[model samples]
Target: MTLRIGVIGTGAIGRDHIRRITNDLTGGEIVAVTDVNAESAKNVVSELHLNAKIYENGHDVIKADDVDAIIVTSWGPTHEEFVLASIAAGKPVFCEKPLATTAEGCKRIVDAEVAHGKQLVQVGFMRRFDKSYRQLKKIFDEGKVGEALVVHCAHRNPTAPGFSGDMAITDSFVHEIDVLRWLLDDDYVSCQVILPRNTRFAENGLQDPHMILLETKKGIRIDTEVFVNCKYGYDIQCQIVGETGIANLPEPQSVLMRSEAKLSTEIYVDWKDRFIDSYDVELQEWIDSTVKGEMNGPSAWDGYVVAVTSDACVEAKHSGGIVAIELPERPAFYDQGNNKVL
Candidate 1:
């Protein structure tokens, strides 16, 4: 049975998901789509040669009877509204990051879904679907690495054009906040941000590289370096230090060439290219699970926790001190997500 999907955004990420579902994956079809710019939605249909109904507003897509499940890839601020509407309509929804602009907004969606008495929302944190991370998770779960003590991570990019302010911590670091919690199966207890020397490449003297220190409840220390102006390439690195041994995230497949007595491997310039396959796998899994009447991905609870974590990070970034992450105890309904960090 093909699940008729409605996409709430026709922007880059939304368009990619539509192409993936229509071309790469199975058990799903793009039936309805809408964006803030109506013409953009029409262009997506025309450009992709999709036979989908274009709507004026996202709510209309959720209201359509043919749309069995909804994908909320619209602007971050509009996520909560469309997700809540999908839940009220008794349809499953796949929401992209931020979940909402604020942690309170994310909690509202969590409360609404809990009230609906079903798991109907899945967040778009694609790192969990990466094969390298999956392998590391399995090794950790099987006790191959003993107990994790310290972790070093790096999130780098060649350049960020319009990025400024605390977006390095708020916008880009949110992905690390969600995925690391899942990788270790632990919740963050505190967070602190260190603004290192600024890079001249940053727009308007923005803080280019920020070092984030996170302490888990179990006293595991994790330091993540967020460098948006590395002037090299998009690079993501995670290495776990354990009692017995250490493990690192495997690098992407690339060819090695020896030229003039020099050897080098290609580095990805765009972030999407680094994890394109993971995104495809993530959405395909979401589609298949939704078809089975299941929501086996990042839950609304995870989204709320990420928002809370992100807020704490932002606070620490400004205060130049550690901020405790005071999160509510996980409700029983969403414990399924915590069990395996799906």
Candidate 2:
């Protein structure tokens, strides 16, 4: 049975999802769409030649009879309401990260989902579906790297136009916030942010080259360097220091070119290029699981925890002090033990 999907926010990510659902994947079709920019939505519908109706707003798309499920790719601030509406309508929704712009907003979504008595929301944390990350996770789980001690991560971007002071933590580093928790199967206890010098390329009062220090409940230390004006290429690196051995993410698989007295491999320009396959895998899995009346990826609780942790990190960034992450007890509704190894 083809799941009829309604998509909100026909921006870059939203349009990409519509393309994936309509052209790249199976068991799903986008039947309705709405965006704050109606022209963009119309253009996407026409450009893709999609047979979908343009609704007046996101709520109308959610209420459309033909839309069996919902996908929220709108602005981060608008997520809580659309997701809650989907839950109230008893439809599964795939929400892009932040879940909401704030921790309290995320908690509201969690409360609504719990009151509905089932899991109907999945957050788009696609790194978990990356093949390389999965391989690293498997190695860690198998004790190939016996008892991870510390993790060093780097998230680099070629250029960041709108990145401002706290966005280095809230917007860019948030991915690490979620994936690290999944990798260690542990929750964060405290966070601290360290700022080095800023790059001349940074604009709009954005701080570049920030370091985030996180401590897990299990006493593992993780440090991430978020450099938005790296100026070279988009690079993501993670190295796990363990008791017995060290494991790291393999460099992006590109053909090595030896010419002009240089050895080189291509670097992706953005997340869209770097993790396209991971996004495809994540969406395909979501489709398959939703068809089976379940969800098999990051839950709403995961989104909430990341939001809470991110809030702490933002506070740490501003205050120049270590901030403690205070997370509520995990609810029984989420099946915590179902995390798959590899």
Candidate 3:
């Protein structure tokens, strides 16, 4: 059965998802879409030649009978509303990041989904689906490494033009907050943020480089440096230090070039080029799993956990002290990772 998907938000990421569902993937169809900028949404429909309806607002698309599932890619602030509505309507929703702006908000969504008595929401934590990360996890599972001792991670961008305040923590560093927990299969017990010298390239006094220290329940340490204005290229690095061996995330497949005098590997400048395949696999799995009435990806509980973790990180960023992360024990509802208990 084809999953008729209604996409909310026609921004760059939203537009890409629409294109992918309609043109690239099977088991899904873009039947409806809406955006804040109706003109831009219309332009996307025209350019893609999508056979989809342009609703006046996102809620209309969510309540449409033709849409079997909903995809929320709008501004972060509005995620809670649409996600809860989709839950109330008993439709599966695949939401992009943050899940909600606050931990309390994400908790609300979690309660609603739990009361609904089914898995109806999947948060967009794409790194868990990336091939390299998958391989890294397999190494851990297969005991190639004795035990993970420390994880070193770096998320770099060529430059961030409009970033300010704790956006780096909330917007940029949140991925690490989510994926690291999944990678380790442990919850963060404490967080501390170290603010280094601001990069000269930072716009409007934004803290360009932040060192976030996280300690898991199992005593494994994960340190991440989020440097957005590196002015070189988008680079994502992760290395697991284990008792016996080490595993590093393989960089994107780039040609080894022996240039004028040095051998170099290409680094992508745009994020889209970096994890495009992950996005494809993530959404395709979402489509396939949703069709079987199962949500096997990141759950709403994971979103709430990440929100709580990011909240603690931001608190550490402001207080310059180690902050405790207090998360409610995982309800049995989420005990099943890739399967529903019911």
Clash pairs of candidate 1? none
Which digits, one per residue and each the tens of the lDDT, describe model 3 over residues 122-222? 99889998988898888986888878999999999999866778888888888998888787777889999998988888887788799999999899999
Q: Which residue segments of model 1 deviate by more than 4 Å?
A: 337-342
TM-score of 1: 0.97
Model 2, span 1-342: residue lDDT tens:
889999999998999999988888999999999999999999999999999999999999999988999999998889999999999999999999879989999999999999999899999999999988999999998999899899999999999876766887777898999899899888899999998988889999888899999999889999999998899988999999999999998777999999899998899888887998899999999998899898879989888998999999989988999999998888887864265311
| Residue 193 shift from truth in candidate 3, angstroms | 0.5
Q: What is residue 289's positional error in candidate 3, in angstroms?
A: 0.5
TM-scores, one per candidate: 0.97, 0.98, 0.97
Model 3 CA deviation exceeding 4 Å by range:
339-342
Model 2: lDDT to the true structure: 0.90
Candidate 1 residue lDDT tens string, 276-330 = 9999999999998999898888889999999999999999988999999999878
Runs of candidate 2 exceeding 4 Å displacement: 340-342
